[model samples]
Target chain A: MTADPRDLVVRGLTKRYANGALANDRIDLHVHAGEVFGLLGPNGAGKTTLVKQIIGLLKPSAGSITLGREDFVANPDTARALCAYLPQGALPLSSFRLQEVVELVGRIRGGDAPAVRRRVDHLIAALELDEWRDTAGIELSGGTRRLAGFLMAAVWPAALVILDEPTNDVDPLRRRLLWRLIRQLAEDGSSVLLVTHNVLEAEQSVDRLAVIDKGRIVAMGTPSSLKAGDRQSLRLQLSLVPGVDPPAPPPFAHRPIRLGQRWHLGIDQSDAPEAIRWAQDRMAAGVAEEYVLGATTIEDLYIRLIGREDALDRAS
Target chain B: MNLFTRWLRSYGLMVTWELRSLRTVLPLAFVVQTMISSGLILGLGFLMHDITATQAQFLAVGVTVVSMITLGMVMAPQLIASQKQSGAYEYLLSLPVPRTTLIAAGLTVHSLIALPGAAVALLIAWLRYDIALSVSPIVIPAALLTLTTAASIGFALAHAIPNPMVTSLVTNVLIFVILFYAPINFPADRLPVWLASVHQVLPFGHSANLMRAGLTEGLASSVGVSFAVLGGWALASWSVTAWVVGRRA
Candidate 1:
């Protein structure tokens, strides 16, 4: 019987730098093919190190990385030929024009010059680098350079593409373009391993995510699945009738506001049913107004999984 | 494909780019230095009262050796140091290509830059000295040996220490010290015993001696031994350079 397509396996992946510090400690990861996997982490969570091992850049101290049963460590050249990596600090060669850089990398994929040229032109137009095709890398703006760097890797014919912070300096429009390109890649049956701290970006881009914290995976699942938490809350506001004082919200509610004789309640997602029943009872008691249910956003999950206070501290 | 062919392909590509870079930097220097050295050697020899064919040929060989040293010790190091600072080497390493190709390509370019100077020196020597120096069987091999040895030594030094200012200082000092013991325009008869003893071990003096022997007369056993010595130094330097670059990669 043939092996299944969902077959990336990493076991006991350990990496200790020469300075006696543990970067990755015996981590295990299994990523299915044709699926988008996001590596979410804080700045120094060893995300890049783990990605390096996966890309065959750095050797793990103790680990067995396999792609569909073939040993990646023992046959790195073959593994590398099958995958494309866009490193976090990737930059284009200053001497090469945008067209030249793209064409060169495309040629490395064993494509003929005409085919490579066609692909380069298509990518340039798709990425809106048409006007900058002849411009050197150093002369381009920071965001444009980043786009070029990303396109070079994405143009490869490899099965798996690993991108580190693809949208770091990209603006919203370019980010949309990049996402369209990524979705196209996934639709073409390629696996994309996205490493980024932009939870909002990852929220929309990845089919699934693995959140890493302090050199280990703290959580892993689809975006919706991971964000599905009991702590989800809805903020409901009720406008009181003329000349009537607003009533207090339930004990679970906090930050109740009285705006123009109105009442607001913060109720959890689970409490929504009971809270709605209570609201009906209050409405029968003549406390009247409309309310809004705020579904928990990915940003809220970001804070919950990491920590809100810690994020604020980091931002400060 | 075999490893050698793969490496050779990469080396050819890198060498082409390196030569393109040299066009802006040392190509002019090579032409000007060769002309100046050739003119000086011919003019000085012509001014001598009893300059014989052998002595003029000797002077030509001496000037050629000096030119090779200038290109190897000074120009090669400067070019490599600039490439490192410009992030060119890092760019090359980031490619799937081998590092040995990069070093070998650089050395090949260095040897190429030295060729014009040697050719000019030999032409002036043959013309002004009125010596019947042809492309002897020995001259081709001797020149190749000297070129290869200079390139390997220069490359090894550049790879070992890639700092532009430091490499310049060290190369100049090394060239000066090596010149003191080598037989250039000045006669080697007045040298001290200690210095003469040191000259026996140094490669420049031996290189000049071998080249002079090859052009003016047929190759003797002693010149053959000098050729062997130069070849040995070249082999060792190339080996060490490959090792260091491999380890760093």
Candidate 2:
């Protein structure tokens, strides 16, 4: 097979601390260019450690990491020049103003001050951080600190940008803005890696994702593909007649969920037709209005891939 | 673009941050130290009518030198330990900066805290003894050696110790012990010859001796050996601290 030009190849990457804790086990990951790749895992599952190793913050205990074909271990400065990383809740220096923090990070990453200023100005404006641009980092609100971190990561326009938990502590509106920015980065041909605990958020935003558990990748694919390959589960919303109580009659018994004035059930896709048929038959017998069936959501696929228990465990 | 420039940038940023923090804490420390010394000496000097004008001058200079040593031992280690605790050192390590920059920045900031204490002590001496003070050519090298030595020892202690509070307390005790009971605390003649030999070997004793030799008129001839000892301590301490930092990295 031809070597992929637009990808980072991590082969047998392992990191063992001196105390003998293996933060990252032997693992491999491929992130294609122009595709937003989400690294999903629970806290301490090595998501941050793996990302740090990928970005050259920590050397792997054993393995080779290549960024677009360049050996990162041998020349980390050059490799790092090609990527930007926003560590989890990375703080700007307390003494530095928001604009100074962005400009300094941008400059260190090889952008000129004037050019950095323009880009930083645009990012501040885009993120609605202009009002806080001159405020010192210690004085900013938590969400503003997050905005500063996002600006620092994006201000340089590096080829690959890794953001760890970019949405945590951010308000919903700014989270939407951040998601849009990640999409825009990939659209502009820069690979984006998002490491997060928010599976639903990743599902809505990532072009593809890797679900890592206990230092290993358990699943990797487009969100829909991962969800679809699990034999396609369907969710149905059905309204029961006023006097008809819900019946739990089958082993694939309805997983009760609320949708408007009806009760929803998660069922195997193969059984969806029969289940819908049953629902329709009930409706004819005097069931209420509104019966619908739709493709499985990412949350459903995530549950199946990792198993319901594992998913809930990871989520908790 | 070059390693030197990278080193300079990193070292400059750290030094700026260190100096900013030192400024916030140094003034109160300087005032407290000065007041304590002045009060103690005034109460004691009047009781001892045999204290000569020259001895009074020596006493003031001794207080200042002791203050420098105290600040270096107490303030410097606490600064380093606080940076370690605050995650500042880890943050610095994450950058592309060389390790020597961290050491240099820390030393430079601590040495700066010594400057004002030294100046204030001199002013008190000039007022109390009517002594005309000049920047003697020997004082430059001597003061630089003393400051550099004090800073390196501080760095080494800070690097070796994990806890800031414990380090500061231990350093303060060490500073007091070396500066108070040793022959270096007074004229060398006041000590038994055997104990004087022992006092001369202590790092603070050497620092105090060197400071006295640089400031006093009759002791100018002894400044050369004092400079050499001070320089030797500085070099040794820096190497030790650097090794510790390298191992950490």
Which candidate tops DockQ? 2
Best by TM-score: 2
Q: Count backbone overlaps in model 2.
A: 0
Ten-residue stretch with the least lDDT total in model 1 chain B: B87-96
Worst 10 residues of 2 chain B by lDDT: B88-97
List ranges where model 1 is wrong by over 4 Å: A1-7, A90-92, A234-316, B1-94, B97-249
**Compared with the true structure, what per-residue lDDT tens digits does model 2 show for residues A1-316?**
2355767788898889878888888888878778799998777778988887776667788998887768876766555668787778445356677888778777666677799999888778777767888888778877788778777778877778888888867888888887888898888878899998788888889988998877888888888778765455677767766666664444563556533345656778778778877778767767556577886676655554444433432222
lDDT of 2: 0.72
**Model 2: fnat (fraction of native contacts):** 0.04
Task: Single out the weakest 10-residue window by summed lDDT for candidate 2 chain A.
Answer: A307-316
Question: How do the residues B124-154 of candidate 2 rate in per-residue lDDT, one tens digit apiece?
Answer: 6567657644445666666777777887888
